[model samples]
Target: MTQRFEYDVVVVGGGPAGSSAAYEAAKNGVKVALLEKEETIAETVRTSGVTWIQNIKEFGIPDDCFNPIRNFSFCSPNNEVTISDTVPRAAVLDVRKTYRWLAEQAKNQGADIFT
Candidate 1:
């Protein structure tokens, strides 16, 4: 038997977008329900791992989540340096941990997170 309940807002994913939305909405005293199809929230990294890092700071994300890699090299198909930049940045994220943290934030805001 399946039981269904109504909510003011139902978020269909546990990814960044859906999780953020659910967190914000619930934080503002809205009834929210977050649904995730996968057993683990983070599936894979579809985009490049590089990011300005400032973006995450702006969103109040913790710096400990990233690995500070000061040096990185780039090589093309022909072994040409198409692009290279010496910037203090970080990579290597525990995707599962990130998702779990985000989901926890949403849950803390009174959202009902379910798989």
Candidate 2:
């Protein structure tokens, strides 16, 4: 059997960028299809999973969804660097869960997601 799909917009990967693109396009009333190679979207994380706290807030991600990083350190053979913040500057999101959230948003906007 051969199946065919036609869409006004097709977004690939289903990562944050793709999901957001599909959501935006679909919300504008365009037919959108989001294609993801993974059997389960976000089964693997492609990102470092660390982002600024401000970005997390702007995206409406709940505080509990990520763990705040308050201290960090990097060391070389002869040198070292360390950073400590009174408030967390970065947070590590539960990538799989986060991706699902983004994909859900796209689906709610009428984007067809295939993973």
Q: Best by TM-score, which number?
A: 2
Provide the overall lDDT of each model, using Cα atoms, as 2-decimal numbers: 0.76, 0.89
Strongest candidate by lDDT: 2
- Prediction 2 global C-alpha lDDT: 0.89
Q: Which digits, one per residue and each the tens of the lDDT, describe model 1 over residues 1-115?
A: 9998889999999987888999999999999999998876676545444555666666566666666556666777777443334775555555556666788899999999888
TM-score of each: 0.78, 0.84
Which pairs of residues have clashing backbones in candidate 2? Answer: none
> Compared to the true structure, candidate 2 yields what TM-score?
0.84
Q: Considering only N, C-alpha and C atoms within 3 Å, which residue pairs clash in candidate 1? A: none
Off by over 4 Å in 1: 1-4, 43-48, 77-92
lDDT digits (tens) for residues 45-114 of candidate 2: 8677889999989888776679999999999999999999999989999888888898898999999999
Instruction: Tell me how far candidate 2 lies from the true structure as C-alpha RMSD in angstroms.
Output: 1.9
Q: What residue runs in model 2 are displaced by over 4 Å at the alpha carbon? A: 1-4, 78-81
